[model samples]
Target: MLYGAQYYRPPFPGRACWRRDLAHMKELGFNCVKHWAVWNWIEREPGCFDFSELDELVALSREYGLQVVINTVPEGAPYWTYEGNEEDLYRTADGQRVAYGGPANLPSGGWPGLCMDKPEFAALVAAFIEETARHFADEPAVIAIDVWNEPHLEPMYDYRSNMLCYCRHSRAAFRAWLKGKYPSLDALNRAWYRTYSSWEQVEPPPRFGTWADMLDWRRFWLDNLAGWLKLRAGAARRGAPGKVVQTHVAYSGILGNRIVGGLGNELGDEFLLAREVDWFGLSSFPKWLMGPDHAYRHLIHNEMVAEAAHGKLFYQVELQGGAGKPGLLGGEVPDAGDVKIWNWNTISAGGKGTVYWQYAPEPAGVESPGFGLTGFAGEDTPRSLAASECAGRLNLPELDAAVRVPAENAVYASRSSDLLTFASERREEMYAGSLSGVFRAAYERGIPVRFLHEDYIGELAEATVRFLYLPLPLVLSERETEHLVRFVERGGTLVSEACPGLYRPDGLLDQEGTALGRLFGLGHREIQGLPDWGMVTACCEDGTVFAGKWYRQLVNPGQDVRVLARFEDGEAAVTERLLGKGRAVWIGTYPSYYHEHGFELDGGGKRDGTRDLLTRFMSLGGYGIIEKVEVPECESSGISLAPVVRLHRLEGEYLLTVVNHLEREARVKVWFREEQAFAGGPGKCLELTVPARDGTCARWSSSRR
Candidate 1:
């Protein structure tokens, strides 16, 4: 199911064509296809409906052992249908109709979005779902339906002239929702910083406000969008019984778009999952616009899969299939093997399924040929053949099943922390895309770390090992603090940055001896800001030199607490102590901020030694397993490479995989965790083995057990 294609043709093609495509897909090892019905396309030919093509497509897919995920088109429903209908088509501050831009914006006009509050729009979607489901429900190939693509606060442009719906419907709904949450408008106004005289006087917060208010407003907008999605999902499920309904959420990354707001996937996904979406779909693009980093790309995709895999197994619904081609923002084209490399990386990172942004290149568009797997002519070119071959090899049942193993270690990052530190104006200059850098550093070194959202910290604590990288201030709620204490008490390693336990969830300053502080053998004091090149030297008790920005305690350590490293000023920078069988390490600086300078002595100097020391400490802490391998240049860039190891039991024989991320030839040295002897092998000693380049299988038998 991880191998699939995205089909963008207008309504179903003929039965013969459908059968041919399905059979071809099966032969190439594709198990699924993402099918879409664009909103504008459906609106174009109103009652002149065509189900022949859809019926045949479904039938053929079923016959060929392929699953179909359908997307409702009407994404850009025609403007004529709702132009004069109501003020519901995204209402602007000055109120004007949103225009639909041909293929670009489709269906809806301009920047405004289709009004979900409009009864007519809901009815239109319901009808489409009902009719579409009726035609294909009997086909075993049909697995699910994507309710919509990415829907955010109206469109981006024309915000002033056409603000979001301030119309009666939205106003009334917001009031009702607020009333249910709060008893009175007075309380609401107090929390929202509103000076409104009455419920009618209540208005959406102005465009400009304090960062705090902006954050809240952004949250409100996400709730609004989620409300709309829930309504649509409910209607669709009612119409299509026994059908899985879902939607795709495009990764805005650090964009802070209102659609995601502060909730990110936590609340947003919870809402969708509650609405009965069978599977979640995420859009992931990891390559930097400026340069390529294979290791970083792998980490980004891995984080995406880990985060999105909260519900049922997630799908990489809009994977980039090719490199940038001639386009508005044209750049270097992806090397021949880029597509295949990224695809396998997606799967290795826990993606249950993947669908390329496009199967064939677009003839004309803002990004015509930049993201398609197949060329415009739809032929199996070299790149296509390579992709096909990779898919064919991975289709083996064993490899597919081997991907289900849960990560051994979990790493937590708060969305709020990511927003505060990584999304700030100085982010690029300070962090320099090092979130992935740290992740890659750990991954390439064979660390089995999985990125997790803070909301899921409790779930992660249940894993073998849990690590939290809190670069920003940690303001914990009473419940969260309790959770942390419990996690540490039960033999977990809690690693935190400086200034943790400084603030409460409500943004009030936490008293010094608060819950987290006493547990970690530290106290919050004045936080000193480190310039980009400032440095603090920490000489470890073990004689290791550590240097970095100094953020937290001028540590006066308590009994039983070990000062692992200290500043040149003799103040502790890294401290470790045991509480029960559990352990805690408090790093009073952010090592993940590789691009920034730390506290120093009057002049600029790089302070990266602390980061290096902490990395080594964690590696030796038994937190993860590490190994090294040499991959030849041909298989190194432009393609994906993954060393997959499958173990049946703690003692059972396992399969090892060395994938080539190239188009033609590749030579690689696969290194795996040294295996200890089992009944069929030597004693408890660990050992490493390599398979020959041309060998399909290699076995290393041990002499004694």
Candidate 2:
């Protein structure tokens, strides 16, 4: 594992003490360091390049026995490049050119870099990337090159109205992409519900009335970003030849605006971006960006990135180093305990490496005196000490050999649903909430859950996946719908929430001929908007009454389908049916969303007897369908051992990780099914005691007595 912190970002903690910092990194048990080669700071004049500072840093890093990953910052474009290239400036929907200014992270001005869609500006970016890669191509200390920093529409431009690239070049690119998607111009009009004389008349929608047009526009941008990544990777490889090329998004595009805090943010599609790079990664700052105490939220964030990596090596590229902000408004500086939990969370999620944001805080700029593992005077902090200890633990040979154990249980993630939610509602709160809610419930139950993307839904029948949870699937493509049907017929259990496949992938209503109606063996009726309390109660055959949230959808089950649960009004709320050799359950409302939004706790701060409708169903009669990895409940915490209990295996050896999410210690016994093989063979229970806000890592071999 490459364990280290981002040591430098030019003009901060400058060349004055480069040796001191590099030596300190080695002493802290770090084997790697990352540096940003900001464009504005490097290539100040057109066609003029300077590698003096970078070359010195690389030499010093080699002396300290630390590997370096150089991050190229094209978004920090030089002012000279933008002066005469004013036509290439990023334009908002209103056609206003985004003014050049310094962002918090980039102290040297030239913020909101030139649009890469423009061929002229793109050539310049390619030149900068190739030059940087070539500069360190022969440097042994420079192990990798990060082509793009936080691949998104426009870096650090969070203004909603000013979303990106409404320029002529972007329009041309969109037109070309449309031509490739549709066979003819009339086909485009049919899909987008428009009439156009020629393809030249086509342009991305300036406003969002038509869902189809908006969905196509968003899809084009996602594909465009992926194309940009490919350009940068190609440029880097051309220069460096053999160096590992990588890039990380700010966070998973899967979570959308929940973590990014923007409305209708058009970010890079992680799954597509991952395919263009050698290693995919994400920048995580839970304490500063996300809530300080939501450990479960942090774990889910990392898991989403890992899922998007699609079996490629993933890293925590920018782990939160210290406090969040620059000055007085800074959030909590993570303590040693926070460090331990966060690092373990990354490891358990199968992260190949982790690099903190920086070795020292920003010395100057809007982000001064923040986000450093060390103090202003370069003194080590508790978080740094904890990081060193974690690094030491990861160096163990057992962890090196252990690989992440794939889960049979999965929560479905749909980009079509995400775009639909954004286009219609202008936010991703409901869709994101529903998906995270079900994932959290399974996570709390000690059930290993992975996210199944729409692109890979067809592979489900051949995969080890047994229990599939689909939440708030408002839209589905024909291909996805067919795969879901086939997956159920092949003996995979599927649990889907309300409004499944209400709209086609193009956002056209499929009310009369809905594929989901056939899949669930039901007919859709009018939806009921509960005005009072806004909750729906469903009672199952075993008298288990659970709450359904976000209103109720009325449905009539087919003759072959059985009504598993009914609302208080005696209307069917949940239906189940056997398809081929498997079972499918359909809930009429968003129980997962309600579970996440309105969870109740007892007097002891533990969850009460109340359980979400999905969890209740899982525990009652659904457990048989799921591939079980059982861990006994915690007596003290009154919950599972932790929100995260993952198993990693290497041949006959196993590594079990139990992360304690409680405030107090937790003790739990974990075991696999009788048919599942593990350390000491199958059905062997391992007892673990984990400290509060910490975790335990145990390794066992079948050969051991």
Candidate 3:
């Protein structure tokens, strides 16, 4: 449970108060501090390395007994690297070259960085990281070295364009990647629908044309970014053997980069990137990025990253310290209450380390006068004091054993489905919304849900997930299809929305041939796409009527399939099938999408029965709410439709974290099952009063103990 804030990066927070700031941070209960090792700032003159300022910073950190994480910023490469290497600069799909200089945050210049596809420039970047790691390898205070910062392609803060690295070097690297993937020129030709005579004739698609080519292009970038991270991490490991190697993404691809034609095209896959590093995490500027709804998105974002880490050590690498916006238009400044809620949310999601973006306000550059825990004069604020209290609680010896992520219900996240949705419709809002809506429905009901990646489906036998949800699953691979059948056969319940496996992994339509037909006992012959905001009503067999938005799947069910619901046209809208010892339930329309829209119009006050519908299906899987929070239904602007309560199963005790989203104090009645009762306790319920817009954590011994 390492707690700290980012402290240095070349020329910020002036050197005059370095000693004082370090001592102050220690007094505030920060056990760790992070510093940037900018490539351009250190290697100003070609190969000659200078570590005077950074060395002093590390020494001061050591003096204050703070562990250090050396963050290497290759994006701020030396001016010399691109002076004679103009060809290595980033280029867009339209053949436009981006100039090299400092990005918004890095005032020292040298931005958009050099292209790693170019071998010569790549070596230089690797050399700088290796050198930086070796420089502080001997220091006991330097506990870890982060190879990359907010890993992404293209320029920072520039989401306007998705096309990146279309230079000659990048094209050559793409060809090499294709060659390795396809095995030969003929296979490449078949996949891309091209008739190339040789590998040299193959070129990365300049524009989106065919689905196969575009998906391959996107997949190539995902792998390429992982390869780039591998290079950086390898260099650091060579320089420092025992030190932890870590890298964090700007955001999870699932939540932030779901747009196929936009940010998704330019960002690295978290799953792939996590495998290349020792520890994986993400930067969360919720206050700056998400306003009143920051807590919900922040918690979900951390959960996604934790899933990406696959049980490995993950963190909130850059929690918002203060104001997040740039320059004169300062972003929302978080208060002491905000700090407590945000910090607890991170810890509840199994974040082992929490570090703010900075310790003091930016002294210069575009981000000046913002993003700091302390004032300009190095004085602590209420937010900083609240952070100290969180640190104290996190460092408790009981915490390591108390806070654990034990989720038995999960929603499926498919990289293939996301890409296919984007390629076919040119927008990812449908898929992204579905995932969000379904997760939100479960979350609001106090269900302990986490995301499950498609690639890890093979681990289902060993997984604890009882209820698996498939949201907007338009495409699924044959491998996934096989495992899903096995999963249902083994007494696991699966609930899926419309159009599951509408497209195969090879970008071919196969509704009848896939496991979807076998498991669900149904297939749709046609899908009628509706206009925006169009509503389609369905009546369930139980006399419950619910509405769905977007398209509707006209189901043609086979024998032995029970029709759970029907559309207005009397077509099967939802069906359930008994497969082996378990069941497969399918909704013929996007109910989750409709449920999401519910939150938008009236803060989820409108009950369309979708929440009850989804939760009822989950009950069949034995994954209902175990520890329920009893609270009145209140309308809210964001995802915090109700009080958020998370129960973690500890060694002998159950640790519960409750977050109140309302403006007024809440007297929450938390009810647990008889098996989950506390040892020698009065009853199955406990009454606790929580302050408005805040949270609290409590623990009790399990009756079994």
Candidate 4:
């Protein structure tokens, strides 16, 4: 993985400027560059080809020793490529065009989204990719290719746009696919609540009948998009053998917004980790709307990227250009050092590389404000300079091995659960919006968390980690349940939330005996629903106080287990017991979410306290202990705070990290456990060491026999 910036030169494109930009990128210690090649520009003029600018840009990048991640511009084939076929475009329910019309009457609006179900459309896309790949294959600087920009739901007035494809071609293909699944239109109609007389009478459902119906449609849409990617990947590989093929997914799902579409767990995981692409990429501009806790967004992006890649290297392909008014939606601009902080945060959270959206600002373009590391004038601003310096320091080879700390536990999230939550009508209020609080809490506490898909249970079982945390509402498939049982039986500490065994694979309620139900010492006798905001005040058996929101488990603990915390209503919020050679801790409530909100609501909204508890829990579980750490102050305003820590490894060595989040800086005193003795080493007993400011590094040797 390499750190770099996005390079764009549209209105003002010259060889000299391209050379200068490449030189500037090199000076800034950028080893990679993300460049875009728009489709309209390529297919606009028949015989008058202009490779002068691109050729110069590629040559300059190679000369400067920078790798190139090229983004194909046909972003939804150009209007001319679609040949004015309305059926070749996304449509609304009423069959209206979902694209904007250009002055030339081309379907030039709304990101040029192509009708993937159209054979002609796919042929044009394949041709475009082949042409682009053939042209750039010989360029030594080109290391990877992004076949398309962000592809998802587009807002066009056409009713066809309301759902996904309903064009003639799409309807035909969809019917065929449905036939493969159900064998008959009558069966399909029964499942989808339709009364179609024949295959030709079938049309896309304008409105979904049930949650299951909507979920199935969502699955179909994902398959459609995945097929497009497959087509593009096949073309790119055939044309440019051995080159890395990748795609970028905007972090809307990470930000608690499902409106942008693209982040479905199963769809995204399978497509991204496919053998067709050597690498996968995710685009993020956290501070845009997330405010200072942009660190949380950075962490989530890394986790999701890591999960999507399934342990392969993933890139942060699009970091924010600068602090500006949020375009399209309202968002925040990071303070002076926020960009550097965010860049580091991304790396610390598992990003192998960082790439800014643009290297220099565009004078006149559709996304001008969103362009550039520097303004339109190309001055080396403070942020740009800081970013360059950070990149330089990060490129140090020793830092690579030194910075990575292997996690001791895996956190598994099911794609089925993620998609179920996303496609649910109540997704906005219930699931999607609430995940950030949990993820943000874990990050703020410096927990080395990795997102794992349910399918990777075998990998989780093989890990040397002492414990695994499975957060609540885990609707399990039989395979997942069996994997969990085996993992627990293998001496791995398993922690999960309540209501673990509920749903079957066919979306049916499974109330009979479940695989792990007895392991959890609970059964589905009652269901509890609470307000969006409520409290679960629990008193631990050890007399510690903890409070949280959402649901809790009413459990009948086995004789071998001990209840940790329970609500006043007698429901268990946290419980622990021995399973196999190890222990299992079940947290009934979503503790991470509660911690994020910090049990208070000021004008700025809720704060989080989940990190503190997680830190303490992991520490108690003998994972790793925090020796001396600075504790951040809780602010009256709604801004998030950072928590810094100096952790002592079991071998008596120390690992120190400064997590300077937004708003407040934390300072604390170091304390050692009775059994733990400090090993004398460089910076081990330093009175004051600033990891964030001076790039302080610490190492300790074990004194244990």
TM-score of each: 0.78, 0.94, 0.94, 0.83
**Candidate 2 versus the native: TM-score?**
0.94
**Best-performing candidate as measured by TM-score:** 3
lDDT of 3 by residue, 1-705 (tens): 789999987787678989999999999899999999888889999889999998899999999999999999988978777777777688887777788866667877788687888888888889999999988889899999999998878562573445777888889998888878887788877766778787787776676667887777777888888899999999999998889999998887767732222225556678888998888888888888765667677777777788888777888899889898744858789988778777777777777768998899987767878889988898889889988988986776555555555466778998888887666635666777777777777766666677889878887786477789998888887788888888888988899888888887667778474656877988667888878757677778777777677888886788989998888789998888989888899988788875444622334323447777766655321223354556646445544545666666678667777776666787767765654455445476767787876777777776643
Consecutive 10-residue window with the lowest summed lDDT within model 4: 101-110
Model 2, residue 419: displacement in angstroms? 0.4
Q: Candidate 1 — what's its lDDT?
A: 0.53
- Between the candidate structures 1 and 2, which one is better when assessed by TM-score? 2
What tens-digit string does per-residue lDDT give for candidate 1 at 1-705?
567777645532323445555576677677888776655554445554566555556666678887888777655565556556655655554555555554442322222336666666667766766666656666677878787665444353334222355565666766666777668877766766667678877665444433333334334555777776776677667767788877766543322222122232222333223234566666654442323544335435444444655646566777656655434754554543555555555555555556766565544555554565665445565655656775665555554444334444444545444333322322322222334434433443344455555566667456555454444435555666677777777866677766665655433457765744667866555566656545455677767665554243565567778888776777778888787667778776656544322323344233334435534534322223324334442223332223332121112333333333333444444344555344455433333332321112122332233
**TM-score ranking, high to low:** 3, 2, 4, 1
Local error of candidate 3 at residue 360 (angstroms): 1.1
lDDT of 2 by residue, 1-705 (tens): 889999777787778878888999999999999999999999999888998988889899999999999999988888887777777778877788777788888888788778888998899899999999998999999999999988888742556655567888898999999999999999999998888999998988887688988888888988889999999999999999999999998877767424422224756678888999998888888777766334666788788888888778887898889888835657688888777778878888888768998789877776667789998878899999998988887767777667777677788988888888878746577777778777777766676677888888877977567778888888877788788888888887888887789898889888864665768888888777877636666777877666667578888789999998888889988888899888889988777764443444234211322244555434221122223445445323322325467767778767777777766777756653333344455444566777887877877664434
Query: What are the RMSD figures for all models against the true structure?
Result: 5.9, 3.1, 2.6, 5.1
Candidate with more favorable, higher lDDT: 3 or 4: 3
What's model 4's lDDT at 592? 52
Clash counts for the predictions, in order: 25, 0, 4, 23
Task: Evaluate residue 402 in candidate 4 and report its C-alpha lDDT on the 0 to 100 scale.
Answer: 38
